[model samples]
Target: MKKVKPKDIKGHIEYLADDRLLGRMPGTEGYKMAADYVIDKFKSMGIEPAGENGSYLQDVTIRKAVTGNDATFISRDSLGNKSELIHGKDFVIFPNAVEKQTTLEAPLVFAGFGISAPEIGYDDYAGIDATGKVVVVMRGAPDSFTSTVAASSMDIGNILQTAANHGAVGVVMAFTNPTAGVPNISRGVNSVLGPDGGIAVSRYYVSDDVKLFSFISGETLTNFLAKAGLDFNTSLTSLKNATPVSAPLNTTIRASYSSSHEDINSYNVIGKITGSDPLLKNEFVIHSAHLDHVGIGAPVNGDSIYNGAHDNASGVASLLEIARIYSRIDAKPKRTVLIAMVTGEEMGLLGSSYFAKYPTVPKQNIVANINTDMPTIIAPLLSVVALGAEHSTLDKPVANAASYLGLDVEEDPEPEQNRFVRSDQYSFVSQGIPALHIKYGNKTPDGKNNLNEQVQVWREKYYHKPQDSIDGTFDFDAGKTYVQLNFLIGYQVAQNPERPSWNPGDFFETAR
Candidate 1:
């Protein structure tokens, strides 16, 4: 087996994170350049094209929905007094992805966290009748819920679906922070389009029944709750305590919005290494990483380009090195290894979601996915956190791989980050494929083992900022270790006869 080289990893990152790539945003020439770079590398490594039409590229049509100026939100009190809320100040409406124009007038109901999980013994909609009404919710789950459960419950898609299940006409997310402003959708919301032209996957719109999805400023929510004979802080306290305070508000909201959409095309670059065993080769093990980033953004310290060096350039580099490692080996694993450098992850896992749902190969033949995204390789690779591994049989491979690499496997130190659902691996997990993403654990040779603290400091300065360029902190040796560890994990899965399986009664088992 060929060892992953730090110099090769450095080379890939240096080229990908160069300023010319313009942050590798989807639907840009810069993004095409980055994709073509991956294609060339795969070709050089003799990796077979496993994308659509026997090419290295898979089409991912992205629809960008921009809220029009005609958007309006009017609130009416029980006495018929109406007040028009200012857009961008009091609230911001998400553009309707399906409907060009939509209008809804309905009574409002406060649904705590908008979660309805009876299995977990919590249903915010138990007492509230949200039928044909607008449901206002805070973006959170009870503290008693696990991190993955909490993240999935609070997901915008799940929230909208939950509201729709209760026959709610709309969903309005209230800002929890007193100083926080409404979200700005000026750049527009993004969603993927299936071959038939309908929405394949989205974070905002669940169905036409849920016409309105918007966010209100903290002050706006406070005043609205006040008129409903409820205190914002008190209601929040009650909800946080799992008391589930839900009631019909005294105010009615009338909302009208028009959306303008612009569809842009992107690609998910895929390549594969065929396995040796005839039967097992029919099944596949996936390696995935996001190829797109936040693109160019507002200037930070005079640098405008949001070069995603650590954000994902390092991840793509790691995958490429993994491909190279496979290329050098004479013996292949029993199961095919599919390397998928996906797109639109920063926009909400669009590319991976599409591929996981509609894979280039037979979906059932896919056994497992090992995702790499922003490994935060700023420190030594002493230990690892295998996100999502514990939920499935993939945990064994992760543990064995970590042990083989002379690394310890630890529980996630920052579960509050909700990283399991924040990356490409969640797409696979959501599609019922057991997956895991490896991240650096808090361990150091100095015995401090406070790497999480150091990562926090690094994140404060660079996580998504333009400062995350090639010039930022990097331990290329750590990058090499990540590549090796991830490659070994996938290799073991590919070689194993029994495919990776979900743990009994796992949270994601029901998804399958």
Candidate 2:
């Protein structure tokens, strides 16, 4: 396949991430506009509308809810003294309390991390039953600075699900390090127009005075513990004990939060290039990317667009380029190629989750999913970082494509980041589909363990900030490599007789 100028993609990313678009926050006009733009492009490409209703639009049913003005968690001491905390201002909380009222006078159990991993021989819930009580768990991982989870690799989200599964009535997180918790996409205290430069919305529902749980900052909790004359480490350890005395302290939580916005329906743009063989037409090679970004928000450094350039504009751009290449190819593939740009990815991967739950096509026939996200801002195309590379038939194919491009391919620099669960691919993974998420550019040529230069730069800047905009000249050649490689992977998978599956002992292997 011949490579064309990546102008269309470059132009698309710039337009979508533009400040005037107001940070493509889903359920906003700008977000709808972004989706419309993708639909229009799909139509212009002469690709068939592969979404529902014979169109490129797949309704994501985006929604937003503003919680009540104030939330107070009041607790009474045995002496009849009482205190209260405000909502948003004091702390932000998510509630599963579907009803109007919830009362908890039960004992509060301190569960260590609320994690249970037999493979690692650690069980936070071992010998403990938190059934009717509020469970106090530490936020982030137990090994805050050391490891995200086990001596292996895991992140907060992975540990969170485990916590949620343990029937912990309410979770009170003891924040050890605020800085450590900042990387948590769900835990940010202040969010403006995300780096996507669009207004962004919170994933958890909000309601005034609703108290499913309340947060205590690490500093505050630590200070208060010191003031109360409790040995912090001892208390921390005691909380994790299976059997412990309940210390009911007079407590109160208060918070105040507000947002202003217009609501609009969002869409997932879908396009398809049909295959040559009639019998294999139903088969598909899917390329996915999220098109939505955090809409406009509070100013940061006098710039608020948060253009989400690398966060995803880069991804959507790559999707378009791949679509263009496949569409222009003279030799057709045996299976169809589906280009799906999802919305509400920043909102807990909602769009992709909906698609996975209710696919327009047969899920089993999907040969593979190539997720393009945050392609590159670094110049000089070096190598491809294959995340979730451990379990897949796509690995060798990726290697083959890399060889074809004269580029080296290696494992992700930080495999423990759980990049697998960080994007839309996880939705498919949950459905048992084999997927690959590749990050192009800033690759290590020698394949040594040294960090990619761009990665180091990204840690300091351009990561989920308004600075992600594409202003100065950026070499997009690496993006082309990503598209080409994925195109080949898809093309190869289309012709292969065997279906892709997970390797032995991989968590999602049973998803097959």
Candidate 3:
């Protein structure tokens, strides 16, 4: 077996993270160029094409939608008083549908958190019928929500899907304050399945014409609910305590929107190395990474390119190194190895979702997925955090990999981020495939907070910004460590006799 070198990994990152790539936006020329680079590498390494039609590129169509600024939402109370809520100030429409105009006038029903996780005995939509009404929901899961379950189990997707399942005409996200950082929906890419992919709110709801979605600040929501003698804070607290706080408000919401959509195309590059053993070769393990970033957005500090050097270029670089090492192995592992470089991850995991829904290989035969979305190379490696580690047997392999490098394996440090559901691996997990998202652990061996500080600095400054360039700070040595860790995990899984399975009683296992 040939070991990967730090220079080899850095070379991949430097090439993919070049400013000339224009952040490698999905469906754009830069994205295609990046895909071509990966295809070339795979072909040069003699990796067989695993994409569609005997090619290494799987074409995925994406749709971009921009909401009209003139959209309006008016609400009328029982007292016959009406108020016109300005867009972007009072409320912002969710840009998930391809509708020319949408008009929905219905009474408001406050569904606390809008979650329906029966396993946890928390059902905000229970005992309530949202049929033909606009459901007002808080902006997050119940405070009691835990990462022990599937990350998407109680997320906004679940909330919207549940609301749609109950026949709701429209959905409104009520934030506690304007500072809730509600994303501006004026610009976004609509998913082929739904706005945010089919993870939660599938195309079923959109096809049913239940597409009204708006966001309101806490003050706006509180004043609106106050007209009906309801308290937003109290409702939120009750929901966290597993108490239902759904109620009907004597108000009617009339939301109208117009949008325009343009079709776009991207690709996911796939290649495989068939295993030596016939039976085990049929069962494959996937090493995946996203190749797309935020692309070129608003310029910052005289820079216009969001190079995404560390955000995802780091992850893709590691994937290339892993593929290189695998190609050099004299005797391949017992199980086939698949390399997946997905696109449109920055736009709500669209590429990965497409792959998961319609896999190049049979979805069931793919035993496991080990994903590296973003591995911080700004500090010395101390530990590794594996998302979804606890959900399946992959945790053992992950721990073993980390231990091999004298590093400890840990769970997600910030579960509130819902990271497990944020990356490409979750797309596979939703399809009942056990997957883990690998990252450099937050803590260091000395227990000092320096590592965390460096992470924070990167996030605050370069994350999704034009400043994310190859010239920025980086610890290539640290990058090499995590890359080796990922390779080890894939090697162990590929040679193992049995496929990895979700742990008994795990929420995701039960979800499947």
lDDT digits (tens) for residues 410-429 of candidate 3: 66776666788888898888
Each prediction's Cα lDDT score? 0.91, 0.62, 0.79
Cα displacement (Å) at residue 50, model 2: 1.6
Listed per model in order, the count of residue pairs whose N, CA or C atoms clash below 3 Å is 0, 38, 0
Q: Write the per-residue lDDT of candidate 1 for residues 437-458, one digit (tens) a residue.
A: 9999999989999999999999
Better of 2 and 3 by TM-score: 3
Off by over 4 Å in 1: 178-180, 226-228
Candidate numbers sorted by lDDT from highest down: 1, 3, 2
TM-score of each: 0.95, 0.77, 0.93
Candidate 3 weakest ten by summed lDDT: 196-205
1-512: candidate 2 lDDT, tens digit per residue = 46556676678878888877777887777877778877777777777899988888876554343333433455443445554544443344543212333444444555555556544445667777766455555553434323212322233334444445665445566564532221222322221222243323232322222224546555444443443355556665554442232232233322223333333466788899898888887888888999888876567789887778777887888788777787687877778889999887886777776676567788878767878777664565667776655576678778888898887786566645556677887667656788878765345556653546557666467676787787733667656666677778777877776667777655456323
In terms of TM-score, which candidate is strongest? 1
Give the Å error, residue 272, model 3.
1.1
Residue 164, candidate 1: C-alpha displacement in angstroms: 1.9
Question: Which one wins by lDDT: 1 or 2?
Answer: 1
- By TM-score, rank the candidates, best first: 1, 3, 2
